[model samples]
Target: MGESVLLTSTPPEHKESVIVSSAPQSRPWDVHRLPSAEGRNFLVTGGNAGIGYFTAEQLAATGALVVIGSRNPAKADAALASIRSRVPGARVRHLHLDLADLSTLKSAVDGLALDLGRLDAVVHNAGGALDDPPRRETEDGHELMFGTNHLGHYALTRWLAPLLSAAPAGRVVTVGSFAARSERLDLDDLQSTRDYRPKRTYGRSKLAQMCFGFELDRRLRAAGSTVLSAVAHPGGALDSLTPPRPPVGAPTPGERLRGLPAALMVQGKDAGAWPVVRAVLDSDVQGGQLWGPRVFGLRGQPRREPVPAHMADPAVAARLWAASAELTGTTDPHLGFR
Candidate 1:
């Protein structure tokens, strides 16, 4: 959805204003060049489909033990089979997780405890906006989009922070969005009880996620912890890029029409997952920095993007963090300043 603007060349005056600078010499990260992830463990939320599935598959192919947190057993089994076929002997398992239901999400860690030796990375990518569904609240009573996208991941990361800290280089890579660039954080009405719109609410949720991700990194650094937190966005990638569904019913004639906008301006899921993968494994990437498609925020390569002015505000971040903790009833003692 953020592909409306395209930057072909950089002018001297606009250099600082641009979120992504075109690096003349540096090449974008190619998945083929990835180092082995052997002995590392990664948990990917929403691993059943779309960008999350591709990210998990890429990790599994690189010899990482991937724990995919998904809500549906059927979709999880299908994704597992796809991974196995593509990456022979791929070590991967699935855990049931419903982002709308906090209790179900909490079970993800406990369910995988026996198999999880050390948490190397956690990829929070499980969130979607319903298409014109009735106004809904999560099981936790928060707005559906905000609760599922922000609060759920907030709790999950806090619960697993200790495990992440124990690893040599742990990371929490949250999948944010390019849509967020158009929205502002509305901390006063987080649940949207006063005024609500689906697309805008989705964008607000993404903004909250970005703020939390950067703020978490700041707190971790202050606490002298090695665990790093960063945010990544899949610019303009759409569901139409995924593999076609098996013909079970009448063919939907206008399906491609709905995706035409994204098709023209976006890359496939394979390329969309690059930023998240880079954030998870790239040693050069540090905490608090954001990664996104370098080519006009639509498609090309992952680049360290500049944080938005609002998101960079420490006061806003602190307020959001405090509110999130209060909403989710989660607190990380390790993050406390000594």
Candidate 2:
């Protein structure tokens, strides 16, 4: 997965040769000294808890107008309040969003457009994982994990395309997962109707998401859109290692002590937010690249890694795009690439 290669064929509209630069930076990306994001606007889905919460907090500290999208109003308020407490004068708000219901997406996007007017980047960070179940489905009749994790973001991206394109350098950062690394997609049965294991099904959903991000890059490049799509994953981020954020996450003293030994292998959710933060703020990051932690693909600082073979397949990506468009009813001819 550490090898780098272009994942799509050139668009017929453009005959010019495209040269993709290497992901290595001349100087290490310093997470502490992030460039200012003043005047820019960002949206983080599922920003009320876990890695998304930390991602919102870190971005808010950069002076960006960050909006936290969540289904729970109380938790959203709590997350915003927590960020303001940590970073005085932080500007953050909440947008009602339920990825499980596709019908509501139009209104959600409308509200976002009315409030923000313009958006610079969107972090598809919110995701659902079912550890055990008789198998569940969304309001849209799709598998809960696949629908919420992939199709939800797929439709959201389509709705946000205009706002993203209007920005000087719009960006779409898909927060994928390390779990996706070991999984392969079953395109014929994406919802796992035939074979459903909680963990495996969850992994397949994420794998679909990563493929969408890469495929998006190809389409964006072909359409000559300025919006860039990049994929990133937070390595092994654990709750016990995560620093306490009142009302959001507050690990007990015993929990912290128990997690001490695991620190060697995993990291806090705050640290897990690094690769995502980098993908959003790092000026050098290019489209269609995969980024992850530096150590054992588990924990450490963020670095660019080669896209996994399964996640990088152009054929698989294209097919998934078609399936997603059909499932989500986002069949506008110019929805994504425009």
Candidate 3:
């Protein structure tokens, strides 16, 4: 591991504009009490299930208009209904998004722009994993995990950039994984064409996503853009530990009992959403920083952690950024920063 960058203090010039929370930072951030985001708009990818659903719900509870981006219309409806049931008068909607297919993204984003006009933040929370495989590829010819996890979000961010930049303070929160801690990217083989193992490939893809997030921050700062990019991870969120949402998730009581023992080491998906939520709403959170669970990095309140050495390498990040640009056809000058 290498030395991680540490820039915890907000720059004097950005102190006023970047602050999102009205609550004082005299104490630890309270997850249950986020600042009102009444007029702001947020888009959460894969907000139909897992951590994404909870993330969207938390943001909706803040009074922001939250859009759940999902490939499945039925699932999106279920998620929207769940949020509405929990948060009365919650402003929420859905955007049909299929990250596996690159061709459809522009239209999806165009629809988003037409509906909301401007976007404050986008949580890159959607991801896919293959338990066992002969091998898999995305519709666009990239490996499934790499395509859907990193490149797909990469393209979405590119298209959403203008809308994000339009806001007073825009943020792109890429949800990374603890699994990436031990993984190193073989940039030449980002799609795992030469060597593809389910676990390793998945980890490498997430690592690529993290690099993109950090690299995006560097580019945004260099351009003097207020659009911030931050990376976060859910420690060890298990389905059994998560509270049931009708039509979305309902682990049996026995499953909950069995998962209770795991609580000492892990947490529910709802709890895991804490760090990502904090990354989006915490005014003090700065770009290029990593946020994760505070307790042994497995379960607890959200707190800023040093970017892992591998994850903080600017050289690797730059290389990955270039590859992503070429792969996604985002080489145009105005795709991301402007």
Among the numbered candidates, top TM-score falls to: 3
Residue lDDT tens for model 1, 1-338: 01212222424443211122222224555554565567889999998888898888777766678988888898888888776655556789988888888777556776566567569999999997865757789998989999999999988886677668768989999999999898998879988888888888999998998888888888888888888889999898865554432221122447556666777678767678888988987778999999999888888678889888887789998989888888887676344322
Q: By descending TM-score, how would the candidates be arranged?
A: 3, 2, 1
Question: TM-scores, in order shown?
Answer: 0.85, 0.91, 0.92
Please state the error at residue 115 of candidate 1 in Å: 2.1
Cα deviation at 310, candidate 1, in Å, is 1.6
**Comparing 2 and 3 by TM-score, which wins?**
3
Candidate 1 vs. true structure, TM-score: 0.85
lDDT of 3 by residue, 14-101 (tens): 2211123445656678776667677889999999999999999888777788999999999999999987776656789999999999
lDDT of 1 at 183: 91
Please list the C-alpha lDDT of all candidates, in the order they appear: 0.78, 0.86, 0.87
lDDT of 1: 0.78
Ranking by lDDT: 3, 2, 1
* Candidate with the larger lDDT of 1 and 3: 3
| RMSD (Å) per prediction | 9.2, 10.5, 8.5
Q: What lDDT score is found at residue 262 in candidate 2?
A: 99
